[model samples]
Target: LVPPDILKKMYVLRRILNPMGTVDAIEFLLGKLRETKVNAEFFEKMNT
Candidate 1:
């Protein structure tokens, strides 16, 4: 399990990086990592 302190830091970073939200920011990063072609199946699972 993730520690609360770490989660808080992630939240702060997420807010600063993208006002859209953490999930969106994660997806955006993943998309970038995959050259803007993130797998649809993986994305769907992440959203669930």
Candidate 2:
């Protein structure tokens, strides 16, 4: 598993790679995570 520091860096990288996390291929995954109570609204507003 990635260490916390590394994981944070990876998450940052992911934001840079897809700032909105709205990639067509991952919308369902995002919705599922949201259903599980994960707070992903930050991603929705990242474009701003």
**lDDT per residue (tens digit) for residues 1-48 in model 2:** 765655565576466557555575377446544655434443333333
The 10 consecutive residues of candidate 1 with the worst lDDT sum are 39-48
lDDT (10s digit) by residue, model 1, range 1-48: 765655565566556557767787777766645753554433334322
lDDT of 2: 0.52
In order, the Cα lDDT scores of the candidates are 0.56, 0.52
Clashes of 1: 0
Query: Could you say which candidate leads in lDDT?
Result: 1
TM-score of 1: 0.38
Which pairs of residues clash in candidate 1, taking residues 3 or more apart in a chain or in different chains?
Answer: none
Worst lDDT run of 10 residues, candidate 2, spans 39-48
